[model samples]
Structure formats: C-alpha cells, structure tokens
Target: MRYFLPSKRLGFLLLALLLCGFALNFFMQAASLNMDAMSVFSWIGEYYWLYLAGGLFFFFLLLVFSMILPSVYAGSAVAAVLCIVLGIVDYKKLSTTGEPLFPWDLMLLKNAGEMSHITKGMIPPLALAAAVLLIAAVVWLLFKLPKIKVSLPLRMLFAALSVAMITGFVSMVAHQSSLAVSMKYQNIFWNQKVNYKQNGLLFAFAGNLRQSLIEEPEGYSRRAIEEIAAKYSKLPDPVPNVQATQQPNILFMMDEAFFDPTRLPGLSFSEDPLKFIHEEESATPSGFLLSPEFGGNTANIEFEALTGMSMYFLNDGSIPYQQKIVKMSSLPSIVSILKERGYRALALHPYDETFYNRNRVYPILGFDAFTSEKDLDNAGRITPEGYISDKAAVQEALRELKASSDPAFLHLVTMQNHFPFTKGHNGPNTISVEGTSPSYKDELETYTQNTKLTDEALAYLQQELLTLDRPTIAVFWGDHLPALSAGIYTDAGWDSEPRLKHETKLVMLANFNIGKEPLNTLSPAFLGPTVFRLSGQPMPPYYKLLGKVQDEMPGLSKQVLIGSNGALTAFTPEQQQLLDDYRMVEYDLLEGENYSQDLLF
Candidate 1:
C-alpha cells in the first residue's frame, strides 16, 4: 500500500535507464540480425526524435507502475528485463531467417510449435547466460533503490500527461510529420534488407505495421472488376490447333537459392558448375528470370508464378501465401486452370509442410495433393543437408507423373540449397572464387557445389522424361539468389545494381522437338502464362490478356519494368493502362468480391 512518486533524481535515473535499454536493444538487434553497427547508429542519430518519443512512452508506463511499486527502480528494472527478452527473440528470428522481425510476426506466435525448426539455434548458450545475469543484476539493484511519495491528484495528472505524450509521439511517427515521410523511403518494397539496414529494426517494424493491413486497390469494386474483365475479354483465345487431345505433362520446379554465379565479372570457377544447364540452354528455350526478391522470400516468387499476379502491386514484404490465400476456393491460379483442362495438379516440396503455411496454401492454389517432406519420408525418401535433396524431389515428381493416367501438372519446390552457406558445409567444394574475400569465397564455393548437385538432378529429370513415351515439358528456375556474405559482388567487380542482383536462370525444356527458340527475359508473374503457351493449353480470359502483356512487357517487377525497346523505363501510358487492368483483375480475385471468378476460372 506504499505510493512512490517521480522525483528529479528518479527522473534522471529513469531517463538514463531508458537510454541504456534502447542502446542494448539496438546493439543486440544489430548483432543478431547481421546489421552494420555504424549504419544502425547513423539511422538512430538521424531519427533521434522517434526514439526519444518511444523512450518517453516506455518511461511513462514505468512511472505509472512506480506509483504502486516499492520504488521507481523496480518499474525501470521490469521494463529493462522485458526489452532484453524482446531483443533476444528478435535476434533469434533474424538469425534463422534473413528477414528482420516485422509486426506481422507477432501473429505467428500462435504457430510457435510449428516454427521450432526456424527458432532453434537463435540464442547461443553464452548469450542466454549473459541475459540471465543481466536480468538478475537489474532486479538486485531495484531492491536497493530509494522511493519517494507524491500526492494522489498530482500522480493522476502526471499519468494523464504521459498518455498524451505517448499518443502525440505515435501520431507523429504515423503521419503528418517530416520524419514520417523520410521513413517511407526506408521501405524499399522489393528489398527489405535495405530497409532494415538503413532504418534500423525498430523503424522497419513500425513501417511494416502500417503495410500489414490490406488496403482496397484504387478503383477496386465489384462493378469495376467486371468492367475490366469485360474489356479484356476480347483478347484472342488459345489457338485451337495447338490444343492437343492429350496435354503434355507439365513440371515446374523452383530451385532454392539457385543462380548462375559465373555471371559475376572476372570470376572463373575451377569447373563449370552449371555445365549441363549451359549445354541445355543452347538447345532449349532459355532466358534470364528477374525475381522480385533477393536472398529470401521464396514463397513470393512461387505466388507470382502460380497465380500470374505481380508482387509489385502488393505491399512491401507481403507474404501472399500467409496473408492473401485464406480460403481454398478464393484465388484462381494456373493450377485451377490446368485442373479445369483435366490435368491433375500435384504440388511437391521436400520440407516441412507448414513452412509459410504451404499445407494450407497448396490446396487453396487448387493442387489436388501436396507431397511435403513428411509425406516424402513416409514413402522412404532420403534427405540431404537436413532437407529433401533435389535428386529425391525429382524422383518423387516422376513417381507422381506415373501415378495417375490423367495428364498431370507437377509443381515441385526444391529446398536442398537453402541459405547459410557457411564454410566447410555441404560440399566437396568443387567451385572456387578468385576475386572475393576468403570468407565469401568459402560461402560461394558451398553454394556452387549445392547448385551443381541441383544441375545434375535437372539433367537426370530431363533424361528420364525423354525416355518416357508421353510428351512432357519442364520449366526450371531459381526462386532467388542465396543469402551470401556481404560485399561478394563488390569484391568480384560485378555490377551491384538491383536489377543485376535479382537476375536468375530460367530454362524451358521439352521432351518432344518444340524447335530451339530463345525466350525473352521474364518475371515470375509471366511464367504461368508462358507455361500455358508452351504447353499449348487453353487459358482463361485474364491469362490471355496477361499473355499479350508478356509479349510486350516480357519482364516486370517493382524495381524495373522492361520496355518495348528492351530497356528499363517507367511504364508508358499504354503499359500503365495494361498494368492497371491487370491490377484491377488481381484485386477482384484476391480482395474484392471475386466478381471475375467465372470469367477468369
């Protein structure tokens, strides 16, 4: 029943505690997330007011608790402990996934049991021990601190002022402030690493909190979607002659962290890791694929490829698999179109079925069956590097193709080459790097060796399909580049431009002779329509429009959209109109009342 009030001495000590808490939070977050200390410090200095407001808010909460607590130090100590715990969790999350912690991640706590694999190895034993010691020291200090008394009326007034100040600070950070405008740029839509690296984790999280809410697309309504769908309905339908009685078995494989490292300038490997790919590209339909993500966010590329929707239109760092696809029959995807054409669509991934909620998402995408890591193992398949090996994944795809007499569409997502390509891991180290630092060289070598294994698997799959009597086509591409050590490109004298960083290899190989025609560069959004074209399958009205756009645009992402001249340009009026129509249709399907379902499906 003792009441303690804030004094000048206590206020100064509390302010000092708040500053110390923030410092610890920043340092821990930076170290755990592999961020540059200097850059984080600079960001903090530039946005000091935001942090000051945040500090005062926390300090005010402590003051309210100090009214009932033994002393102000007790409340301060409690707040410090909570911040330390938060820092540890954030550090662990960033270490496992290159993605920094976002506000949306808090919703994922419900699935913590499923995320044990990802959350493991986040806190080292030494770090855990240190945190424990720090918490204990703070608690011991709290007991020795002195307490002050204040009148009840003054305490009530102080608490009200604290609440007002907190509200003012939050409002400033959210809107109508100069710092808010600058913070918006910190969010580089396609590349979240830059956002976190430049703005610091706290600001990045705050920015994403606003982005997490799904906003209605401009001009999005039931009537608008119907009108857009009707306008694009006149586009040419699939050519009748190309639609064979028996559709070819379609296999689309997204190799994890797979890219051609030989693209780096002045870089020579001990041997060509992608020798098979190079040989096949010469005789097959091949081109560079521009991905919307780098380092991670594999699911976003998969979403674009299957749904024929552009991530550029969505919020920055949005995970459509987790956020958009909530119902099984909502989103119309390529899988649904193929199923309508009597093709049995099967999805395969050699990892936990629950990662990114794939177990739930695949069915929503219209896959008849999803064979995940557990399913593969139940059937007696082996996994390499704690993942389903590419070789094993290909073998499963072939099995699925043969399982049903009906023409099949196999969507295989491989995970043998997931990131953290540390030194002396998963390798005979067949490839060597010349220009990069020793650490980068080691990581690159590991990545190259795994990719080589992936190439061998592709070659095996191609040969196996060739032996089969049924005509089949295989589309192979990388989801994104690996999360290699920083400065790898700068060290190799390669272009550090965003476009170059986002490039990955794409190849379309068919068993029957389709003639060796080269393809233009493509984004993942265009890949679905391109597959329908290559397979000679009839597509929906929206797809027909998308095909036309692909013919002109070829490749488009938030970072760069290919012009008719084959150069990056701001979308021309015509191009913008096409994109606007596309966006309207996408909104209709994903967020609006699904007005275009019958037309698209």
Candidate 2:
C-alpha cells in the first residue's frame, strides 16, 4: 500500500526505460553495428555528443509526461506487450540492406529455440543481473527514502540529480557502435511503454512505422530482380505465342493520373480526349483496363501491366533497388522474353535515371537500352518546377522508336501531369492552365483544367502515332487517380466515404487497320495478357497465371489485401482464395515452411 503513494517509484523507472528504449530503437533501425564493442565504440565516437544532447532532452520530456499522467505507467506496460506481439507478426520486414536487424530492435526472442549465441552466450546473464540489481535498488530506495522522511525540497533535488545521472549514462551509451546493447534496451523500453496494438502488432513494429511515416525511397532490390528472372526463365506451357509476319512497332504510354471516374457506362467526361482513341480508320480499341492503385506508385501499376503479375505475387516488401529485400520476377522477365524472341526493348523517360534507380533497374528489368534526362538532347527544357512536359517525352520516344529496328518495343512513361500542376512548356508554344481557388468554388474547374492538359498531351502523342508507317500497338492508362483538390470519385458523384477506393480503366488502341469498337474487359490484370494476345506475342508463365485469375474475376481488379480487423481481407472472395494459394507458395518459398512443385512448374 505504501509503495502505491502519490509518487510511485515505478513511474520513474518506466520513464527512464521508455526514453532510453526509443533512443535505442532509432540506432537499431538505422545504424549498422558490429559484435565487437571496440568497433562499435569507434563508430559511436563520431555521433555520441549529439546523441547525449538528444537523450537529455528526450528523458526530461518522458519524466514530465509521467509526472503529469500517473496512469501512463500502466499504459506503458500495455504498450510494451503490444510492441512485442507486433514484432513477431512482421518479423520478415526486419531485413534491411546495410542494417537489417534495426527494424527488430525491440523484439526479444520469445522462445528458447530462437535464442542466438549472443542471447544464450553472454547477453542473457548480464541482462538478468542488471535488471535484478536495478529492480532491487529501486525497491530498497523506495522503502528507505520514505522512512527517512526527508524534506520535500531535498527529495526533489535528489530526484532531479538522479534524472541527470541517468541522462548522462544514456548519452554515454548512445555514442557507442555496439548497437546490440542499445537495441536490446530499446526493445525492453518499447515492451514497457509503447502499445503496439494501436495499429496491429506488425503496424506498431518500429520498421513498419518508419516506412509508413517516412518518405519511403523508390527502386527495386537485387533479390527482387533475381526472383523475377528465375520466375521468367521457366516459360509457361502453351504460351500465348502469336505471329509477327508484318510486325508492327509497339508503343506503351503510361499517362500520369490518366483515370476517368465516369467510366461507369453513362457517366462520361465533359471533354473527351479519348473520343478519337476509340475511332480509328486503321486502329483496334480495347476499353476499360482495371488498375490497382490510384494517385501514386505508378511503377507498381506499370509493373503489373507489363509483367502480367500482381504486386501481390511479389515478396512482402518494396522492390529493393540493390537486392536488400525482395526477389522480383516480373517486368525484367517480360523484357528478357521479348529479347529472346528477337524483339528489341527500349525504355524512355524524361526524368533523371536516378528517379527510381532506373539506370540500374531498367537494365535488369530487361530493357536493352534506357534513355532519361542524361540522354535527352535538350538540356534546358522546363515545364512546371520539378517535372518535364509529357509532350517532350513523347517527342523523344517517337524519335528513338523510329530509329530502332528489329520490331522494337518502346516503353514510355510520362511525367507532365504528376502532382504540382502549373503552367510551363517544353517547346516555344506553352500551354498554361492555372486558376485561383476561392472557397472550393474553383476546385472543380482547376482539376478539369489540369486533366485537360494531360488529355492534350495524350492527343498529341496519338497524332504523332499517325505519322509512323509501321503497324503500331498503342496502350495508355492512369498510374493512379490524380491528386485533384476536389475528390475524384466525389466530383464524379461516387461514394465519398473512404472504403476500397481503387478503380481505373486501361484504353488500348492498335494501328493495324482494325476498326474502332468499344470492348468490355473488366479485368485490371488482363492488361498484360490481353496486350500479348492482341500483339500476337507469347505470354509468360507468370502472365498466364494472372490471366487465369483475371478471366475468372473480371470485377476484382483494383483490390489489395490490406490488413484490417484480425484476418487479411483480400479485395474479393476470389482474390482471397488466390491469396491463400499464393500465401502457401510464399510461405514455402520465403520461409521454407511449405513448398509446392506447381510453383516451380
């Protein structure tokens, strides 16, 4: 009963651990460390002073929070338990390139079997001894301090001094390279303070939180490349091989935010840039391509359309540009397959090659040649502050495509309509679209204007397509929904409530003298397979697998298995089953838990 006084001793201990834990987690998640203490020390020397200053500030913040909210001690305990649980759920995400274990800085081996030599060898004994000593010291002080009945001022002074001492110790530890000690303590703190269950166990895990909260980087990892290539090497039986007796040049154009909300039958755009796309005296048109994401992550959509494999089929991580995470196997495979069949594959973009590690990834992804800003003839073309105009990119693509031989495949990704829509131009004739938004009155007008600019660029590209003599297959689709100030679906009168808002269509136009007709193909994954089918090319094994699923689930195109509730919800029941099957193969391949020979075939 006495221990539960106005100033509970556990409060101080909890604050100390919580502050220390967060600091430790930061080091573990970002810094690389060695097992040898001396090596870690050498590295820590460079940044220890800064760490000390930060630690001093953080410790006081936690101390004040504890004094203000006594119930926070109990809350911290709950948080710690949740953090531990979530660490287990997303253990696979801990793999980093230079520093993989940093993500798992808070996770302690729950079972004896998981105990590595460091834990079993020296850490467990030292940690147990330190913890017991610290607990015993606190209990002894609590009992003795109250009995002594010291003056309130002296007690306060002593507490402040103790806080200072602890802060100094944390600073000393912070500057050391031996991240194991810091990470271990941080894990202990997270277990005591942060409730991991707020976002689900995995979501609460330090690595997952960092990824979501930070400006996550773009690019594919080496593991992803190898996986994609391996998957591609084993060709599917009865591949969708078609003849190219009079081979037509292929132009793959991906427009930035090229989505039409009124795609639902009667709902249509006020200005139709796509009207001409559907009526060519020498063209074939395919309507309504289902897309996966909206407003961002264009590469993923491009990956799906070109590779015929959903990102769901990918390893549960970003496509690590340098082999730190995933084992990719889609786009690169598509390019490789095309190359083997005597088709030259070239990729063109107006942005820097470093934009998404395009220089490194495009080559591995199977493009025979890559042209970006480094290759752009004109060095001084500006449109908007950060983006190159879409028309300029098209002009570059056309110039390169016309010069290439051997039935080439040109992949063109545009950047003009990428966010921050402003007036700028690449050529002498500049098209400007800007308006002042007065209380959302001009929101719709502004968005329509921006979309009009993108439509104009697409129309210009189509016009250029007219001049080419070789038969050409042209396909275009939105990367994601535009970040229009007015909500895309709301402006179009779709449900405004945020629930499963990922749906867009792909439009395909072929210049083989095929009549323009509106065809209903309600599958997003069909973009890859259908493209191959219409182009008379061979479908890869991965594409065939996706093709089967798309054929079965026409309406289930834009759904993803986002973790909500306790179970993973697939976009639809059909997708749920497909996920289950994929998960089984995934577990086998990724974790060595279960293997299916069918996956190899």
Candidate 3:
C-alpha cells in the first residue's frame, strides 16, 4: 500500500540522521572503554547488534527533537554535542571513582561546582583532542551545509514515527518483551559495572530507569509495621542506661579509602602499613566492618552507619543520599537519636558541601551544624594534588569538640587517600608489605603512603581526646578500599574472597575503660547501637531491635551473609523471619508510610 507522498522529496535527511546516530554511539562507548580506540572498535565488531541497539535509540531521539525545530543539521548537531559531552564526563567519573554514570545521576547536577570538578580528572590528551576535533569538525561542517527542507507536516509525521519506534524499543527493554528476549539483552542488575560493559551503556541505563518503581515487601501493610514495632517495644533494653555524671563526647571519624594493606591477598609489603592502628586495635575494641560499597559511594556507607538501616534491602546501584534520604522530610539517624538527649550533632567533611547533597541533607538528618570545605578556615590544607588531607579533617573535628560543652556527636569524614594515586603524593613510599603486583606498583606505593598518614591522623585524634578532662568516646573506621587506576583488584583475588574487597577495620577508643574486646566483623548499621550500648545511652525500641538482629546476623548484606561459623551460608527459616521483619521496618521508614517512626525510633 502506497502512503500519501510529500509535496516535495526529502533527500539525504534520513541518511544524515543514521550516520550521526552511529557516530555519536561510538564516541559514547569510547569513554566506557577507557578511550581505547582498539577496544571500542573490537567491541563494535563483536557486539554488532548491541551497537545498533544504542545507535538506533539515539537516532530516534535526534529525529524527534530535530523535528521540533524542523531543521536537519541543526537538530543533529545539538544532539551530537550533548552525547559527546556525556561521554567525556562518564569517562572522567569512571576513571576517578570507579563508578559509571546512571540515569538518575542527573539529579547530582544540581550541586554547584560539580561540572567543573568532574571535568578535571586524568583524561588522556589525545583521546580528548581527537574526540573534540573529529566530532566538532563533522558537526560544524554539517551545520554550515545547505538545509534539506521538509514541510512542517512531513516533519511532524516523521517525529510521530520516531517516537512510536523508540517508545516501543524502550518498552521492550524495560519489560523484557519477547523481541528483546530474542535479542538476548542481559540487564546484569546485580553488578552495574558489568551491566554497562555487557549490555551497552544505553540498554543498562534504560534498565535502571525502571528502578524508580520500588518493590514492596511481602504482605506489607501498616499492620506489619505496627506488629514489628510492638515486638521491639516489648523487648527489654539490650543494655540498660547508666546514671552517668556526664555524657561522653562521641566522634565518628570515617577515613576515606583506608584499609590494612597487609591483609591484601597475593601481595604484601615489608612491614605493617597501619602500625599505629594495629597497636590501638590491640588495646581497644576493634574489628573489621563489612562495608556495603567497595571502591566508591562513601555516602552509602555513611548512611548505614549514621542510620541503623541496611543498604541490602534498598535497590541495587542506588545511592540513598541522592535517591531516598534527600527527598524525605526527616530521616531517623544516629544524629537525631543523640540530639534528643541534649547532644550537639555536627558533621565534618573536608570536601564540598554539595558533593553528596550533605549541605541540605544534613539539616534534614538533624545535624546541628555541618562543616565542609568552604566552611573551614584552612580549606586548602591538602596534598599537592589538592585532595584535602585527613589531618585537616581530624583537626577540625577536634576544634569543634573542644569548643562545645554539651556531649557532641561529631561525624568527621576525611577526604585524603582519594583517587589519581600518583607516586609520592603524600611522601616517600615505605614498602611495608612483603610483595607487590607487577601492574599497580606505583599506585600501590602511593596508596600505602596515604594509609600510613591516615593511621597517624587517627592516632593523633585519639591522643588529643585522652587529654580532655571530660569523658570521651570515639569510633574510627574506613569507608571503603582504595580503587587503583590499574583495576587489578579483581584479578588479585578480590572476587574470590569477596569479603576482602568489602572488609575494613572498625576501632572504638574511649578514655574510660568499658571492657574493650575485638569484634570479628559487623555491618555499619550496627555501629550506632554498639556505641549507645557501650556509652550507657538510653536505647530506643528501634535500636534495641537492631541490636538483636546483629547478634544473629553480624556483617550481613545482600551479597555477604555470614553464618555463626564465620562462613557464607544459606538462610534458615528463623533467619528468614528476622530478615523479613527488618525489611518491613526499613520499608515503613524509607518508602512506605512512617506508621511507627515514633513507636520504633
């Protein structure tokens, strides 16, 4: 059947859209492939169908937007620049933090100074130049060329067709329709890094777009929340509150990317890199913390620690700061809990206030004050590479503590030991370990030196706390393991012994002797309750419930569920009940109605 013909032939416009579509796709994938032209070309050759999938989606988007202006070259040019820029930004993000760009990450753009900061990392000069010159020249040349005129009616028709086709394509990906199934597109929801590599970036992004629809726990209702709340309400206080003459000053100093380098499998240094930490751990209550996040997403670990909530139940690849907490009216956290008893809660981080929306979010979390990079007097007290050192963060916390008379819940987050681990960033590298990997020697040395400095800073904080006449308690821990540019962790057995990648030490030091003992490993969610119990603070029903769960499920997460025997084991029926109750309560607080916020928290 012949459709209605256009008044005049629309020549070369369709071809232009097709060429621009695939070209834009190549540049975008180049970033994810680490600007390796060889790898990008090889991937195109191997995953020909997947390449076409992303390209076709881009083509439809360009077609629809271009039709709005009804100019062929002009529309494609706008689309091309946006796509190329996205590629550059994604490249920088992956290289710097080991995290890829997601669809919802667009919300992070609201934070000022983010764009300039993201564009600053270790981007290769040739790749950046070639991407700019080649694509820019092509786009500029296209813009200068003669316009292929199509009537408004024909443009509208084309736009409608493009919308329908792309909508169908997206629907297929989201719903896993038969056609998409036939194409064998694996979403890889469990591992986002692999998802982007395996399914192509666009397909993986579309997969995440559907994650806004949160799943409800089985038989979720107000009744379920109340039932859980009732159980905790009847339960006895895990540790009764003491009639302390004075409330102790509590400091949670979370060091950036700090870990025991001596513990790494398949490699070692000449001596212990964290000598100070080792000595302190033997004297205090210290053990490993099973950090939910690995290389980056420090905010998530902070969320779990500050709030007695598990990231295990939340959506995969989701950042609570960006996705959940920022939107909520008030989140029940350690800060809020401590503030009820006249404790002054303050947050300290030597990075941008807007890095994780902490500037606005901290107030919502009930922080009395937040001191960030801009707020500091010596904000530039940093390494040569400009990452604010751990020393500066600890000093700021000490100053805040000294100034306040009320028991302060100071949440100190360090920014040293962050990426681009250039050799001698801190000072001379001491090979404290016995061996080394051939691939990541320079980075390993730089990272080792950084850890030594972190240990020293932490020791310094503890020594200062001891001098204070007032009773004081402090907990220091690592947020996550440092990620190297070589990306050799998986090869070096991070995957085989998954705990090694997630494992980080947790130490609790106090001026008063509260019977310190070593902990094998525990989840960040349990840290607040542990501190409360140790410090003789009044325990709320919600915290009491968490304490109970931790007794059974220590260091538990979606991936790592440790058994009583210290090995990964299947869930028992009793364990299943505990898990379900935990999920229901978390859902009630986070996503569902706050039915029992008062009753529980």
Pick by TM-score: 1 or 2, better one: 1
Tens digits of per-residue lDDT for model 1, 69-153: 5465665566556655555566554554446666655656666774564333334679779877987887777667665556676
Instruction: Encode model 2's per-residue lDDT on 207-289: one tens digit a residue.
Output: 23223111211233334334543554464534333455666677788777665533523333445533444343124555554
Predictions in order: lDDT:
0.72, 0.48, 0.78
Stretch of 10 with least lDDT, candidate 3: 1-10
Candidate 2, which segments miss by more than 4 Å at Cα? 1-243, 261-283, 313-332, 377-386, 422-438, 441-443, 486-500, 514-524, 555-601
In the range 1-601, model 3's lDDT, one tens digit per residue, is 1233443334466666777798888877887888888887888887787788888888888888787775677776777778777777777667756667887678767763644553344666787798779877877787678756766677778889999988888888888777776666777776777777767677777777776423678899888888888988898765533445689899998888888877766776766778888888887788999999777889989999998889888866778787778888898888988899899999998877887788878998999898887787565444454577787778778889989988899998887787657676666787644356555787787788888888878888878888887788889889988766535675566656778878898998887875567777989999988888777887888887888788888878866877656865777787788888888888888888878678787
- For each candidate, what TM-score against the reference? 0.81, 0.55, 0.86
RMSD of each: 5.0, 16.9, 4.1
Model 2 whole-model lDDT (C-alpha atoms): 0.48
- For candidate 2, the 10 contiguous residues with the lowest summed lDDT are 195-204
Candidate 3's displacement at residue 586, Å, is: 0.6
Best candidate, lDDT-wise? 3
Give per-residue lDDT, candidate 2, residue 478.
Answer: 63
The numbered model that scores best in TM-score is 3
